[model samples]
Target: MPFINTSSPHQQNQSSVPDLMRKVLLALIPGALACLYYFGFGVLVNIVIASATALASETIMLNLRHYPVRRYLTDYSALVTAILLALALPATVPWWLTVIATSFAIVIAKQLYGGLGYNPFNPAMIGYVVALIAFPQQMTQWPVPQPGGALGLLDVLLLQLTGTLSDPAILDAVTSATPMDQIKTGIGLNRTIGEISTGALFGTVAGRGWELVNLLFLLGGLWLLWKKVINWQIPVAVLSALFFWSWMFNLYDGDLYSSPFFHLFSGGTMLCAFFIATDPVTASTTHWGRLIYGMGIGILTFIIRNWGGYPDGIAFAVILMNMAVPTIDYYTQPRVFGHQDED
Candidate 1:
């Protein structure tokens, strides 16, 4: 009998990279639809623009690097990055900014470090951070949520393309501070959380229209969990840590600090917990490392939201944690089975 050479861990599952990517894309649909319902057509426009830009950039980079373009394109990783970046962006952002962010995400954050699994940081987040830093005015201007979906498709296109509508009042009517920004600003002005919560933007739990969007995202996250696309450690740890910190602060002074529920359901909290922090390539591999990594993100996010310049800090927290993954994994790696330690 002849022995065959092969890789270790001969056992395999039915899931391929494309399969996993497909499931993630599927999981995002409910949240994406909710965004469209609440924020109007600009969200859809951003998705289309980002997706196109990402695909084109990926293809060009793969060709320049002499890699097999078709093989990589079929994996749908670029699409996922594109969609995530698009969703993070303000729905009212100009079309050119969307293109630039998506392109930079695919080309620089992703391919420059050697593409896909090889990249250390989350590509979507890198793009978002870059955009947020580069264009603070555009990035922070989140559209006021219109539950009736009042903004017509053409009006959104006109605004995105020209940076204005025929009537400037329309643009002014739709644009406003996000719930997170509102709370931050209100707090800065010495207004109590109670007074801020009475604003029209505040829903029963979190931001108006935003809480439901987050719930839909939570629904999608649960689906991802059920499908086993992601491990439970990171999400549970992130949410738990965030909740604990927020609860503690709120307990000390309800007038000064927002409640845990507000933090949990507001502005990318659920999305970051389930989708962003759980990026397998960037996150820690060890079981304990995952928990520690998640806790770091949660705590940092809270700190940044409260004390840092940015209203929401998920992006910064994630990137900072990504830089620590190597050290985390090394320290938290499980001991080898049956291996004895020297005294």
Candidate 2:
């Protein structure tokens, strides 16, 4: 009789929540590799430490809430949250930064609203925004992608753990500038795009290495689209809207507003467009809603980059739009079939 109950109409969807989350984690690999190549081994170290910390915090919180610790921890939400946060953060950020941010992300931003699906904010972005707000200097210390061995896992771990780095000199200089920072500062000082964009900025980007890294993420994003892991509506919409606005502004005054490519490859444009905005729980499920949600993010991203205090707008924009998901879904809901005039 219990087996017969399996045929009941109240069965859950075939695709498990855990399975979807796993696929998202897998999609991050190519982009992560690109980031590692550009930034250094520090990113890899960040991933491992952050993920481990996320798991531990998630376990502890689950226990505190009297939830099934083993089952939920194994679901790997914490690991994904850690990975995304690690990706967003600067390589040379201190170890405690990761620990505190990861804990807050998993506990308050995620579980406090009644665990994963119930949370309104994206866990990774929540943590990232908090870190950025609390420690602006550390969060902004992005690294340049050098030709040779810029970083190593063990070296970073040593620095993180003991504060007695193997080569303290090299470790101290590991930080580099992000493309957005370059453009923002350049434009501020009345330096033409050609002046400040010298080092990594020479090769068709504000930061040379960063352009390629964003390119790799774009490729991976397309791959996700092809695999149907994410819908194209959001990414394409976000990118296009951003480009259109940036282009218009640049045309109006190239001195103040940056070029369209700067808006595209700079900061977390590609990654956020594809990954964060596609979160099913936080994003609208309806097709039209997806397009509108994406447009909102893109508009906010451009506005913030141009005028907001932060150089990057992805985290703030995502969290803000997350609050509107319910309204986006409600109006975008498709009418029930064969209900015409039947109500």
Candidate 3:
């Protein structure tokens, strides 16, 4: 008979990969619903398509790698990645593009690096960046939210499948520049922040509909924190650094810069701060390192949004910080118990 050896301090626990992923999915619901309410049914469609694609890709990759497909697939990590990528994408993105992005995320970014716990970067951000670079035209044209109504369900599905509308004229009227894009362009044209922010797209804080979406994300993030799924340091550091930098710049020249509130509630700031930057695998393991990691992302995000070519820079900033996580963790390693530092 063979004997099994067990490690010391072994104890049963309720926590698991699937359970954690499920909680994350639940946490994302409020924000997704907010998007659906403000954007349209298209958001749900993207989620469904992306989820299916991610599952299929995960299964195939597992088989090719000689891993037990069912065991790995049941964890739901790939599904969460797909959902995050879907939420990050434009509501009207074509089905093929969504498929491509989701596939790349699971196959290349996740599995190629040994999947889930081993992946050094956020897979969703990688897929998003790839899609954005490959299909700039479709990726950037986010649908404008109508005051009373958004795109019809059938119309949204049609656009996603075919990338065209039955009534071409409707496309022109329904699509408008995102608030971030408008700000960049307006500033480039030498318009003061005050003058440009007065457009219909601008709200008291951020973009008209976007601020509400961000608020829901903030609520969801709080739920994650309450559930103890994530530490508070990363989100606090990201938001604080971004707010401080934006305020400093705005104070320098009120006309040249937008307020910190606008920066907080606009684009993907809240989402990145709460969810993306807090990825355990890619983030710092030590307490102090997490704060520094988050601060780096926040400062980079601010610089890219203000000075880089892209209107939003959270994806780029997160990737850059992911590269530094190894070094950060090495230096910030927690002191071992029963050991003293040597002089």
Candidate 4:
């Protein structure tokens, strides 16, 4: 008698790689739109350039590796990586920087490690870290929030392409250090939180335009949770850990430590907590492992942001936690059914 071949997950939903990727892409829209509104057309241009480069690089790598290029391309994983990396980048970065980062993410970070499921790190974070380390100046050149006048599409294109503008004063007027940068510098100069918070760059909760961006991203992340695309353990753990640390330190010295609200609402905290750190392939798999992994990321991000060289530490924090997922899962795995401990 012939027997049926069945896998452990005999009951399966309709979820496929493409479906998951599509949902994630949809979830990113609100945050992306907010970035565009605050940062200008450069945000859109970065996405376009990064997406095109990701597709082209993915295709080339697939063809060279003798894989079925068309089938894999349909998954939209590369596009997600490209868009995530682009969003993490400064909107006004040179166009070639976007191209380089996206290509490296697809070719080295994703494909070089045997593609999607086999990779151990988040490709987008890897790409962003690479670009940041290689070109610190360009990576930190964030545009001022709600500039007096937004750069036109042509102006953005010209500036990104040639690293120059017809009017030098416009470039100077539009660019400034991000809120995270300002806070770090201010604290280093012995300025109190009250003093720094008075700057025009600081908004109600965080930065002028960044607070709303983070809130929108938080909404998108909530949507992803509602759609069942991501688990709750990672995000909840990350935020809880971050809040606990920031709140504790703020109590110690309000002048030296920023409030939890600022930490939560500034920079890419929401983005990392939800989307980047929750990457299924690179993140911890076991239930308890995810919590530990997320807590590790949250703690590391706080440490790096306060004392390390970078203004925003999400990229570094994610990458560091990604390296420990294997160990976390090994120790935190649930006991198998009918298994007993040897006492």
Clashes of each: 0, 3, 0, 0
> How many angstroms is residue 243 displaced in model 3 relative to the true structure, after the best TM-score fit?
0.7
Per-residue C-alpha lDDT of model 2 across residues 16-112, encoded as one tens digit per residue: 7677678778888888888888777778878987998899889888999999988898777788889989999887778889888888899899989
lDDT ranking, best first: 4, 1, 3, 2
Q: Where is the poorest 10-residue window by lDDT in model 2?
A: 199-208
| Per-candidate local distance difference test | 0.91, 0.82, 0.90, 0.92
Please report how far candidate 4 places residue 341 from its true position, in Å: 2.3
Give the residue spans of candidate 1 off by over 4 A. Answer: 1-11
Clashes of 4: 0
* Distance from true location, Cα of 224 in model 2, Å: 2.0
TM-score of each: 0.96, 0.89, 0.95, 0.96
Model 4, residue 99: distance off in Å is 1.0
Error of 4 at 53 (Å): 0.5
Candidate 1 per-residue lDDT, tens place, 162-257, comes to 887878887777888898899899999999999999998888989988898889889999999999999999999899999999999999999988
Global lDDT of model 2: 0.82
Cα lDDT over the full model 3: 0.90
